[model samples]
Target: MREFLQRTLVWLIVILFIGLAFWAFSGPIEGLIAAGVALLAWLGFHLYHIALLLRWLEQPTAERVPDGFGAWHTVFMTLYRTMRSQMQSKRKLTNVLERFINAGEAMPDGVVVLDENDRIEWINPMAMEHLNLDRKHDVGNQILNLIRQPSFHAYMKNASFSQPLVLQLTQPRELVISVQLVPFDSTRKLLLSRDITSLERVQTVHRDFVANVSHELRTPLTVVGGFLETLSDMEEVDQATLSHFLPMMMEQSRRMQSLVEDLLTLSRLENSPKAVMAEKVNMQDMLDTLMVEAEGLSQGRHHVRLEKGCNQWLWGSAQELHSAFGNLVSNAVRYTPEGGDIVLSWKAEGERLCFSVKDSGIGIPREHIPRLTERFYRVDRGRSRGNGGTGLGLAIVKHVVARHNARLDIRSEPDKGSTFSVIFQRERSAEPEAQPENQA
Candidate 1:
């Protein structure tokens, strides 16, 4: 306002000077001088009036009614600039929203959208797969009612009007879903859901395995200790009976030892970071040693052969790869029929270095195949214990493969046989080590 008043004063003075010069040219010298003085007084009067007008124009239209064209100009330009800024902000927000929509739909997991009223608004491709949602019916429907889960329904009904609600999926399988509600305003809400089923399943399995293994080992250990105490108080027991008891005690101790060692190894793998500084493991050397060890364990009854064609080295911890490959190969030898042929093959498939241990064994059922890697999850518990299987080979294999940033594929059919494969990323050439035949 001060600036506008100053500009007006300057423009008004310039106009007065021009007017006086024009009027002075048509008069006598004394008269022209007098007219010039009159013009300066006229200029001051006009300048004061313009100043008052500009000050009134600059007053906020919301507080004062604009009474003239001059005042209206100020109000109109102020509103236009404010509207322009608001429009630009909305455009930027829309761009961000569009990008979020595209990224959310592209996700591999399920996603659902909800309006402020907790009604379904949108769903992603993955939501269609996991939820079996029919868009035509699901859209515009209340989310809690559509799911039809009592717990979820109650949760949403009593949900905090301003926050999110979480519900577990207790349907086809036990799945954990974290549902988040983003409230833009009291009348707007966005729902985001993430599937944590696999994570929760892993946690449950870990807990159950620990409890089961502890019980299994402790029971046998207690019995063996009791037998040793009885042996010490043998006042009339036969030596044959004592001898028989000793072997059983020794076998039980060995089983306990194997279980403890495998548990420790699994613990290490799990506690450590998933990504380690991967070193190049010579694929040929790795398989050759595994086959040799496996053959020795088989006592030459089951011939283990290695087919090596992968020039690429494996990119991971050599020790981890050895353990992963060794477990798979040795597991095959243990399960395969006597005198059966076990083939260990390695080749490069795309970016992955693939290795497989194929054996003629009692194959696993389709349902059990998914969980065979779980600790102590035996297809035949009696046979497994009788064969001196600690029931941790597959579990160990799983952890080792994960440490190596590799994938384990278990393909088997009933009675035909099973093939366990580990797919590893190819690495740069590694320094040559002892040929892939040494087992130490």
Candidate 2:
């Protein structure tokens, strides 16, 4: 108020000065005219400066204020400085906002921002993948309306969000999602989602593994325990009966031993970070050893043949490759009928070298083919037991192939025999001439 009064007083004094000066030269009427003209000129000067300021405000830039207005020039400069400061602050805030959005986009989990009314305000890229949301179209739509899951709706509606909600979505595919909400900025909410399908699968596998191990051990233990009780109860058991019972007990013990050994092999393969070291493995030598082992396992029950024409050497762990190759050959021999033919072949197909075990035995059903590599999975449990199989053969083979960066391909149809092939990467295979004779 004081500044306003001071400005008004100054303007009035300037007009009075003009009036007095005109009065000294002329009469009072002329002086009044001169004062009015002077006042009009000053008003026009201020109006011109104000117009420039308004124009600059509409589209501001780093340009100097227009001059020639005297006192008004100072005011214009002050306004320019204030505007420049505001622009700098706005640029800084925009940079920070962009960084925040980029960090959210890089995250694996999904993030979403919602208004007080549960309407989506913004979402990251991962949120689009997890929730199948269109960022542009989904904005302003209620989150509950889009998700529409009962568990999620109930959790969102509840007053407290103490725990996260797990939901299974079956749209794009089967997916398990864990969703949680956080209250922020007073009424606004931040929602987070994570895909837990793999974790859930691991948990289920662990449970089944424990139960299977217990069941496999329990059956043999019961058999051995019952036989021991019978022997202890009899005072004078006949020699023939004792011999028969002892052989059966030994067979049961051997079965248990094989199961334990397979379990150990699987555990070792699962825990190892990588192959110990990659060396040139002679495929011919490896196949020779497999043929001998297959013959022993077959016991003349099946005809086994080997057709070798691969590069002769592959770069990988010798033990691991041997184990993997031996498993496939032995499985073929075990499954083949007494008169059926089992063919083991190593040949180059395209860029890959394939080690295949083809058998003319009972083929696998289409439904069970996918899970043939699973531990303790058998098409016929009684048949596998009678053939002295521990059911962990294919599982071990799978791990070995993975360690060597190879692929396991199975083609089978029920009653038409089955073919199992391990296709090694071409990069890992070497020609006989490329490797030294000693190394080969």
Over 4 Å off in model 2, which ranges? 1-11, 24-27, 54-68, 276-278, 430-440
Give the TM-score of each candidate: 0.60, 0.90
Candidate 2: minimum summed lDDT over ten consecutive residues — where? 62-71
TM-score of 2: 0.90
Residue 398's C-alpha lDDT in candidate 2? 95
lDDT of 1: 0.74
- Give lDDT tens digits, candidate 2, residues 219-266: 888999999999999898999988989988998899899999899889
Residue 79 lDDT, candidate 1, scale 0-100: 55
| lDDT digits (tens) for residues 278-329 of candidate 1 | 5756676676688779879899788678787655665567886687778887
Error of 1 at 168 (Å): 4.2
